[model samples]
Target: MLKEALAFKRPLIFADSFFVNKPERVEMILFLMSLCLLVYNLDQRELRNSLKRAKTGVKSQICKLTDYHTLRFI
Candidate 1:
């Protein structure tokens, strides 16, 4: 999700220096970031699917029961 991509603060910071000094390295940095996000999302999807199949929910930050889990929750 766009929110997940935007929430990646530390990776952006880590890739900042590379963008300014070695432009070519930017591709690799972006690739790695994308890969990490993909993995995170896939895992989240699996968790949500599993929970749904089990017909259960978890408490969110606000203490309300939710079937959909966000990155912040897990």
Candidate 2:
């Protein structure tokens, strides 16, 4: 899961989209990314909980119904 989450943030390794030479800058960027990932996971959990409480589900990528939708999908 950790690997997938990190890969999701930066899809392409050779993209060179973000370049930080300084250690402080790299640390800051990592901190921000971690915070954002935390928020994303929390939001997904809340959505899943709410759907379960409501006894409803959204269609998944396979076109099947699922209340425990993944954070990466939906």
Candidate 3:
């Protein structure tokens, strides 16, 4: 298994064909998510402090909605 191999530095390459529009939707979602997370953490001190203080809270739980979206492909 690649996980157990420890020496798994094998180089791999793809022909850049699948790098087109099909997976762009997923990548776009992640990009937008990243941007939202960036702007959100930037604009709100409360959110930052909440993240700093939380083991469990609704604000922290909000990412789980996006996780469900990401999980849909699997």
Candidate 4:
């Protein structure tokens, strides 16, 4: 995901640099739309990974706590 973002960054920066001088309304709007889409997708991907990690961590901790309680009772 980081690699993909890095790959995308170069072209986006180049396009912005190219258009920054002329400052056309339509081009700027399009650029903004594309940037928003890229950011949204990247955010979603990162959120999913974070949630997955949290879930796995919670499961492991729960298992450990359960084992500890069982041992104490025994």
**Index of the highest-lDDT prediction:** 2
lDDT of 2 by residue, 1-74 (tens): 66766675455444367788899998898798789889988898899999999999999878888899766676
Tens digits of per-residue lDDT for model 3, 1-74:
22422232435323342444668776886586568655644545454455456544332244552211111122
TM-score of the candidate numbered 4?
A: 0.42
Query: Which residue runs of candidate 3 sit more than 4 Å off their true CA positions?
Result: 1-21, 46-74
All predictions: root-mean-square deviation over Cα? Answer: 3.0, 2.7, 12.7, 14.1
TM-score versus the correct structure, for each prediction: 0.72, 0.75, 0.32, 0.42
Whichever of 1 and 2 has more lDDT, that candidate is: 2
Off by over 4 Å in 1: 7-20
Q: Write the per-residue lDDT of candidate 1 for residues 4-73, one digit (tens) a residue.
A: 5567465535534443457666677778878987887888889999889999999988998888996656
For model 1, state the Cα shift of residue 21 in Å. Answer: 2.8
Score residue 31 of candidate 4 by CA lDDT.
83
Q: Each model's number of backbone clashes?
A: 0, 0, 0, 0
Between which residue pairs do clashes occur in model 4? none
For lDDT, candidate 1 versus 4, the one ahead is 1
Q: Whole-model Cα lDDT per candidate?
A: 0.76, 0.80, 0.43, 0.50
